[model samples]
Target: MDGSVMQDTDLAVLLHQVQHRTASPEIVSSDCSASPPAVLPKRVAAAFASTDGDSDSGGDSLLRPKKLRKPTDSGGDSLLRPKKLRKPTYAARKEEIAALLEEHRLLQARLELLRQNVGIPTSYDHDTLEAAQRQQRAMEEALRLQQFALGNTQSLFSKHMNALEPNPLKTYIHLTTDAVERRNTLLSIRREKLHRCYQFVHERLHHIPETSPYHVEERYVNAKGDRIISRFERLLFPGVQDVKQVFNALLFYLTNMEISISETLGHVTVRDDIDAVETRVSNHRVVSSTSYGIELELNAVHCYEYYEKFEEMGGQEFAME
Candidate 1:
């Protein structure tokens, strides 16, 4: 009897400890006085009767089923349905949209150009060019001929020949067709015979008509053996200026010479120095070099023999062009 009582007491203590609520006698109510359960085991009829009926009473509440809706359906359970209309996502960045638009625009432009390329005809074809030519000929002259006029050499040389302006590196072509040019040529031929090579004719290199660029550029090394530029601002240019001027002045006078005759009726030229060199030239008429021509002409009373020394120095035959 004592072991059975002890076992029952331990069982009651174990059941009480499993529940969180206190196992005090005051909390235990008499289930016989309570109402019966809705649906439960009969062995625990008192416990079910003791349970609050509102909590686990209905059989339908225990196996409650969730409703499912098909994609085509729009009635019950539609709130959990797959959407027919696609929603716009706000996560796309601004740069992505702009890039797509730019690509689309470029594609459209390329398509237009391709369409034009297939259909459009060019106006530069031979037929179009020939038509233009025909029209131009009918409107204007049918035949075209090129004509050339020549200007006076003295005037052209003085007016147009500026060495500094063309910068020496420029290309120059002197093609003239005129009476003055012809006369200048004759004068040049005559002067060449005067042996300008020996300081008797063109003493300065620039005295030659094309000599500005034609003359060799002399490289002068200083005491320090450094190359220097040859220019008029330095002493060399001043020394050479007169020689160039004399050539010009001689050309001017010779090209316009008069065919004067003496009592003997010789073919005596009345140029300033036309017959002076070829004839019995006065000592005063000769030039030391193109460099000293101006000084010689100015002091014509005492000009020296310049050509003899040059003639001795393996000199070339004088020009009689």
Candidate 2:
């Protein structure tokens, strides 16, 4: 009878300990039952309840399923989430620019071919057309000023040339079909040469490894073993600027020369129909493949030399049309 009473006392103590351990604020709400908690097995709860107060005694080692951590929790689980992929802005821009540059080159080639075949080139870009028109206007103004200055000098050549056009409209009406055809032929030749020179420059730029920093780094070496960041910038930036200046000068002078020569021929024609024939005879200028004569007359001294250098480098020779 005594042993049974002691056993009953031990069972009650075990139940009390388990109830105390499992009584978290979450589990001990008013709605929770006073009976064994639903999460724990009845046998496991009974076992833990019989243990001493010391946590190291392992009475709480029941294998209840672990609750998954919330995403907001500061735990290693958050680190395992996949990060979003970033956009490749640099690569995307590089490709876009390369495509645009290629398109520009193709358009330039097509324009040249059209100019050669039909004597008229098509331009799609507004800025390009505007720039060409502006350049032509400036050339015309310069030619007019030059004629004015020449007239003031009262030179024999200038006097006779001006004497031809007593009535500008009548002179225009008297222009023979042959003279018109000759002028058109000369203009076509000049346009073809200028276009070829421009194409040479453009293709030269595209071929130059030094123009790009990435290409420069690959091929060029600094023998002094110094750092090359500054050198690379110097090689590409100022060099490109110089090339651009050369290109602009070429276009300006070539256009000016073409306009001036054509204007002179027109004035000479107005003076006497036979003067065009005489001028052609005295000049004895057959349309030579060499642009040296025209280039020299305009004092674009470096133009042909620069073209030759690029031609050699690119292994491309310009053929006269």
Give all TM-scores, in the order shown: 0.20, 0.17
Off by over 4 Å in 2: 1-9, 12-92, 114-321
Candidate with the greatest lDDT versus the true structure: 2
lDDT of candidate 1 over 68-180, digit per residue (tens): 65555556458676769754564355667888999998997787677668875443344688998899987665333211123355445434433225323223334255646
- State the TM-score for model 2: 0.17
Query: Model-by-model lDDT, in order?
Result: 0.42, 0.47
Off by over 4 Å in 1: 1-90, 93-99, 108-297, 300-321
Number of the top-ranking candidate, with TM-score as the measure: 1
**Tens digit of per-residue lDDT, candidate 2, span 81-187:** 67788779998899999999999999988877777688664554456889989999999999999999888775664345334433222212122347566555544
